[model samples]
Target: MNNVDLELDLNNLKMIFEDLHFNNEIQPEQIPNLDLYMDQVITLFESNLFETKRSVEDKLLTKTMINNYTKDKLLMAAKKKKYTRDHVILMIIIYNLKQSLAINDIKNVLKPIVEKIENNEKVDIDSLYNKYLLIKTNNSEEIKASAEQKLKEVKDEDGDVLLYILSIIDMANGYRKIAEKLIDKFFENTNEK
Candidate 1:
């Protein structure tokens, strides 16, 4: 009963990728300021992020993963075995990034933001996360329109699934790469000041 009955094809993937937006990400302010234990953090992800899950086995997060993220410095250390809103926001970014990029890549990409936090600067995780969300959300419309236009451009009305699928992938990569470039540019501007 838990199995998904959806079929995969270019049209389907196009719609899927188009529908994939990060607006559902947990806002920092939504998390409580009080420190929460590991179990609480898992519960938070499970309940709040469950909508992002494609299946029951697709767990949003786990203790070992959290521990590993902390150990790897991809995440800040939990406070007395508890997590704060900052921790949650960072974890959210990690969760999303890990879907496509490798752990090392994710660590490197987020290093600047994490370092700013470590320096005790008034870095706004909320604003940062919001920016990421904005980038992803804003791209959704462009992705949808681009996919639709490209699909229409195909000579075969029945469609060549392989070609369409590859096009979708290219479009997806284009957006993610652009997001990375934007992030890099933001950090560069910050560094210059």
Candidate 2:
């Protein structure tokens, strides 16, 4: 076999060992069934059971309906399994922000809010509402006031796109919070240079 193929095989074996070790730690009795589970996982992978990808244009079209600039961001988040429902709700807020604010400005405003939501911590919605007011007024309040309104109004033609966008947003928020905690930890441990 070529070096690349050998490397790939070695990596696969390492992964199998790791899974076995993890299962042994969690439930030793399950060791006997490990081969069966591995077969299932291999079959699922080969069958494209976890395949999920959306075209950039498709994601953009989805965001366009919502009037948000979060298409690319949401796509990346979804790819990483970090998107969720609340993140989608937050994207509605972002759509309003995009009407008047620059992309960077909108991201700055959303970073903290998304972080809080991902961490399962309380967020100051009033403050966020006020921030939204500073960015855009029209449709902003409506979006914030009724989080589920647009979702309900979404028709069958656009339902899947909307739902996918929402899932991506949710994941993005989760990843954002995880990233924030890691950064905070780094800063906490770092001595001023």
Candidate 3:
């Protein structure tokens, strides 16, 4: 592409990064305390997490997915066809983690807490979810800053879009690898006991 075209492309990419506003995390307080039916749970996720979708047709949660999560033991079974607040909490965690982790890995990660919830024991999942949101918010800022810096470098170097993409892919792959490694270290063997 020509210099002007390349500059425009870079500018568009920078704009894309600048436009990433991630304030859609569902707070625990926002979830209804009353038990929700399947459709209601789906509606809650769809309404609260529409921004997280890459396309209008993309669903944040589906009945099939919820069924499969329960089948796979990634989620606990609902009582009397109704899901509780803890169920919503687990669903939110599953939705986020599924982006980067496999189903089995997610089940492994959530196993202990799932057990606690299933056993009618007190669980502090809200605290954990809140803490996760805090970290995610902090990381969103860092990611925006990093993207701006990288985009500037790429533009200054005559718009090396390939290099910029490669760097992003590398960072994502590295994080995924670390997450997998931690799961292996802490959770993989837990099921065997």
Candidate 4:
């Protein structure tokens, strides 16, 4: 159930236990309610603990996977103390794209976009893809057309960057869903605070 419901249930249990203890004349039938309330509280606590543990485990796994994947692409060449959602999203996208493109090629293609993002400039995927194709390949027109088509196929949402990255990676590795799940868990944990 929700947090409010869980809190109300726990409070009710405490009140009932206190009342029962204060009045020893309470019947054995009344004891059943206390037992039931205690059981519900325990169950809720266990469920919450399990969810929390699972979320932490999922986050840790995602961190490790992304670290290995982006070891060569990190700007500082050092392990990050904290990774933003954008960073994880980018890593997921790059990991997926690496299936068809070499790591160095992918880095070259993404360097400009990453630089723009770091400078707080709006990134235009279509423009970046076109420029990358023009600079790196002989068939610029054909590559630009294909990349544009792929970019157009991606659905834009509130978190378009994350979705775009996940979609690209998923197209290549089918592990986008797991990354999405981890992202959701990450946000959920943040909201709990």
Candidate 5:
């Protein structure tokens, strides 16, 4: 793709970014106890993900995907063709995580928590999900602050949009470097076992 700068309004850009409010996530307590069937589960996904993006159809999830997740042991199997609240919670987490990580990697990341839940150990899945929600709520401000800091660090009176883009790229590269280190540490621990 060409890096030609467009005459974008910075205020509009800020507004666009600010407008990305997260509301699609349903709370753990709000999840219905009435176990949902396959079609109902699919409908839940469709109804819950994005209230906007009218032009975009989110049809990526299907029966096969749910089945595969269950078969792969990444999620607890549905009981009697109906998915429990726990099942729906896991499904939502898995689906969202799938956007950035591989299925196997997702399983690896969640293995400890899922195992605890499965073993009927002292694990509150809902509490864990709620904690995740809390963390997620705080992240938008953190991300915005980071982006602004990156912009300031790269600011140049003579620099155009390319400079800001480069700044973001630098930040992304830094994140990648640290993420790589974390992954290395993760595997190092696993390798010891």
Candidate 6:
């Protein structure tokens, strides 16, 4: 790639990062304190997460997906057919994690939290979700910096885009592997008992 092309690409990349809008994440305060029905939950997610969809036709949350999640034990069953704030929070977490992790892996990672919610333990789920949002805010800058650094380091030779893409894939695969291994080491046995 020529210097002009590189500069343009970097500018485009920065623009994309700026568009991420960390505040776009669903806030704990935004969730209704009162319980919600399935259709309500679906509407809430669709309205809140419309931007996260890659396509207008994509469904963020569906009745079938929620039913399957409950059936698979990834989510707690609704009480009297109504879902709580905790359930909404968990579904958001699950939706994000599902993008990069296997369903079983997500279940393993979330099992303890699910148990706490289901058992009516004083888990302070709002605080936990806030912490996650804080971490997400922190990581966004780190990710942007890393991407900028990688772009600078990438050769200006032909196939620069391909090289950059491969680098990103390699990094993502590495993190996914580490996460899966950690889940295996710490959580694989949780399901045993």
Q: Candidate 1 lDDT, tens digit per residue, 68-153?
A: 99887788887788888888888888998887766766776777777777777787877877788788778767766777777666
Residue 155 error, candidate 5, Å: 4.3
Lowest summed lDDT across 10 adjacent residues in model 3 is found at 1-10
Clashing pairs in 4: none
Best-performing candidate as measured by lDDT? 3
Off by over 4 Å in 1: 1-22, 155-158, 174-193
The runs of at least 3 residues in candidate 3 whose Cα sits more than 4 Å from the true structure, single-residue gaps closed, are 1-14, 189-193
Any idea what lDDT model 6 has? 0.83
lDDT of each: 0.74, 0.40, 0.84, 0.41, 0.69, 0.83
Clashes of each: 0, 7, 0, 0, 0, 0
TM-score of each: 0.75, 0.27, 0.88, 0.28, 0.77, 0.89
**Model 4 regions lying over 4 Å from their true place:** 1-65, 68-71, 74-80, 124-193
All predictions: root-mean-square deviation over Cα?
6.3, 21.9, 2.6, 24.5, 3.7, 2.9
Worst ten in a row by lDDT for model 6:
1-10
Worst lDDT window (10 residues) for model 5?
184-193
Cα lDDT over the full model 1: 0.74
Number of residue pairs clashing in candidate 6, backbone atoms closer than 3 angstroms, sequence gap of 3 or more or interchain: 0
Indicate the TM-score of model 2: 0.27
Model 2, C-alpha of 81: deviation from truth (Å): 5.3
Candidate 4's error at 24, in angstroms? 59
The candidate, 1 or 4, that scores higher on TM-score is: 1
Any runs in candidate 2 off by more than 4 Å, and if so which? Answer: 1-83, 124-193
- lDDT (0-100) at residue 142 of candidate 5? 79
Return the number of clashes found in candidate 3: 0
- lDDT tens readout by residue for model 5, 96-187: 67755656666666666667667878766777788888887787567777776655554434455687787777776786667556655573
